[model samples]
Target: MQHQPPARDLPASWPPERTAWLNTGAPMPLLGLGTFRLRDREAVRLSLHAALENGYRLVDTAAVYGNEAAIGSALRELLPRCGLSREDIFLTSKLSPRDHGEAPTEAACLRSLQELGCDYLDLYLIHWPGTQGHPQGDKGNKERRQLSWRALERLHESGKLRAIGVSNYTIQHLRELLASCRVPPAVLQVEFHPQLAQSELLDFCRQKGIHLQAYSSLGTGQLVGRPEVVNVAERQGRTPAQVLLRWALRQGVSVIPKSASPARVAENSQLWNWDLTHADMEELSTLDCGKRYCWDPSSVA
Candidate 1:
């Protein structure tokens, strides 16, 4: 998942602990099919079909990935075929960085909604803290993000967005938003895996009641082959990918693991009906050395 950046015919029924509650009291699946590089219309349909059939109810996409229309088209054809309605799926799309002002943000959100063929989104996020085309620490970036948040606040109030949040925000950035916004964020999604645990940010989100969602949960496939991770997988008779994803789940964090292979997508959906022990948790936690596989948001002002 760089730009930046699972099992078998397991269980169909999700345990009570498998879901995370957003601040708005909305439930989010800890596991979902993330569509980052799946841009082709056929590819989106294939993955979405596999995911829905495999008991995955959450699908995450973003504007910058250029796949909203593909996902929208796929959902329209596939949902009915899969025996589900739009409400049965928790669809999430994000605000584009180029659309970082009040009016532009609102327009972009509406366009995404239209593109995705949804009346309302289950969740929407400010894709980044800094406005594109600006320097890393530019003051205008802060202003634009503030204005963008105001736009999102209005949309949330209007019920266009069921829940609103931010992604790739550091603690400092979240502090700014939490202090000034009319609505506190419902979730804080970031690059999380064993290598980059983000302990302080997790604790802060927990303290403030913001659900922490993990992207790049496999460290872009770099961490899956590690000795420690493989050891746990061998011991538990699971895939290393599942170990990494389960690591996030056991700690009350949610994950969106994107894979092009429908088989891999199905494997990732088999996260339910399993447990990672306390010792497994401690061993996986040792991989934390603050190495982020994705681009860091700490550079943004």
Candidate 2:
């Protein structure tokens, strides 16, 4: 069954308490800045600075994103100016599929730490269930996943990773990991939007106390053009992007939306202090058609 927290009255402020407690008892900001496919260092620096100025406390990056150093530079330059410290921000990065074995995974984490100039990560995730060089049908795929997960467990024990989790894992993959994992996953990052609800997965994670986080929450700019989303935005006096983000938050999930534009970054962070009506929620929910703006992991096996 899906878990539903009772709705409270709307607040009369700009930044509401938009945090969810992880299994580790640490508070994670629900809305964050995602750095994916952002290769330009100068652009990344400017965008990240703007995001921090706009009240984004959480920043998500991955080794595959190839922008960790850029983000690190931005943070180093902007944190003190913004009157914040490292502890005040939540930083997350993922292990690449190419580094799936135990030793490689551990090495990769250390490398990421060095590149980001951080002593530890707020959260680390397995980028995917499958290995990079190994074929999908390779018998060692599952073993590799298990080994990498074990490495993550050890890192968690060492306090290098405050929380550990996986991304792009389906129900079957999650079940397998749960069966053998010594430490339960604290979060599951996946491609989520109004058009790809993944209701079953969301319910299963909720029951297991795994915080579900949505990536590509705006459908990579497709949902903004949808009539349903636009209509809801018009009625609620919010932007189409805000309406989509609010829809995700209403499902008790966290969302990380990416934008290099300063204006868009500030606009996306304005999700607090308001909400959508029940009728609007239902209308948006009915638009789910399994559309994915990112890679599909259902066939990872």
Candidate 3:
């Protein structure tokens, strides 16, 4: 078999300001372990443990990810070893489309709480506009999302969620929700990377007081070995993934890079040591291809 190339490594030290507080006034470590598509329970376990051991306190998961229980197990088992507790970690989960509407949304969040074995979530996001996939496929998508968001608002008011947010939401959706909903979302999780810069939406969120969280911060592996990203990394003496991640961070966005492997998990967390200057930032910003790796919510609703 051909030998695989060495995986990228994280820097030795990072800025202590790598953590940011949520709108709920809860502290969140800027870098988190994304449990999206992390596959095996054991792999998730190892990665979660490694993240916790390596100073990661934020963990992002969703009902759609189908790994809340495994993540819960990892948290329960690893925190003790790392001399931490549930309070020390910032836990986040999402409501799936199948769990839309008032009753189902409430039940789904309760289930997520049960699955994570936590009393309250640091943040709970409405995973997507649709209950499952494309919102355009279902007529009830818009209404269902609105209803589900209302339920999330109740949860936040009742103290079940410290903060409530939406994922994969476009400007139209956000505006619609803002016009109708009582509480504004604290964060908006989106599939943002160098390939799909999301500059406009990010700017909207910033101006509207909604923080942006960059999911697929490394393009879900598409940017791993890309020459454009790699060249920048080589020039900076950093890994391409780090360069990509740092690019998002330089704009004040939180990131979650998923990996079940210990080395990669550890590597993903070390992104705060160096700052990308204004020129480097502008150069990387030009790399945007306006291509999204995930479904674009803008087309749906």
Provide the overall lDDT of each model, using Cα atoms, as 2-decimal numbers: 0.87, 0.88, 0.81
Model 2 agreement with the true structure over 1-301: per-residue lDDT tens digits: 1223423322222144677777776677788899998879888887788888887888999999999998898899898998888877889999999999999999999999998999999899999999998777677888999999999999999999989999999999999999999998989999999999999999999888899999999888889999999999999999999999999998889988888888999899898888899999998988999988898988786
TM-score to true structure, per model: 0.94, 0.94, 0.91
lDDT of 3: 0.81
Better of 2 and 3 by TM-score: 2
RMSD of each: 5.5, 3.9, 7.8
Residue 157, model 3, lDDT: 96
Off by over 4 Å in 3: 1-16, 133-139
Provide the lowest-lDDT 10-residue window in model 3.
Answer: 1-10
**lDDT string, candidate 3, 94-145, tens digits:** 9886788988999999999999899999899998887664447667788888
* Candidate 2 TM-score versus the reference: 0.94
- Candidate 1 lDDT over 1-301, as tens digits, reads 1010011121334444565667776666677889998898888898888898888888999999999999999999998998787767788999988999999999999999999989999899999998889888898888899999999999999999989999999999999998899999988889999999989999998888888899999999999899999999999999999999989888888899998889998888777678899998889988999998888888898
Cα miss at 202, model 3 (Å)? 0.7
User: Which scores higher on lDDT, 1 or 3?
Assistant: 1
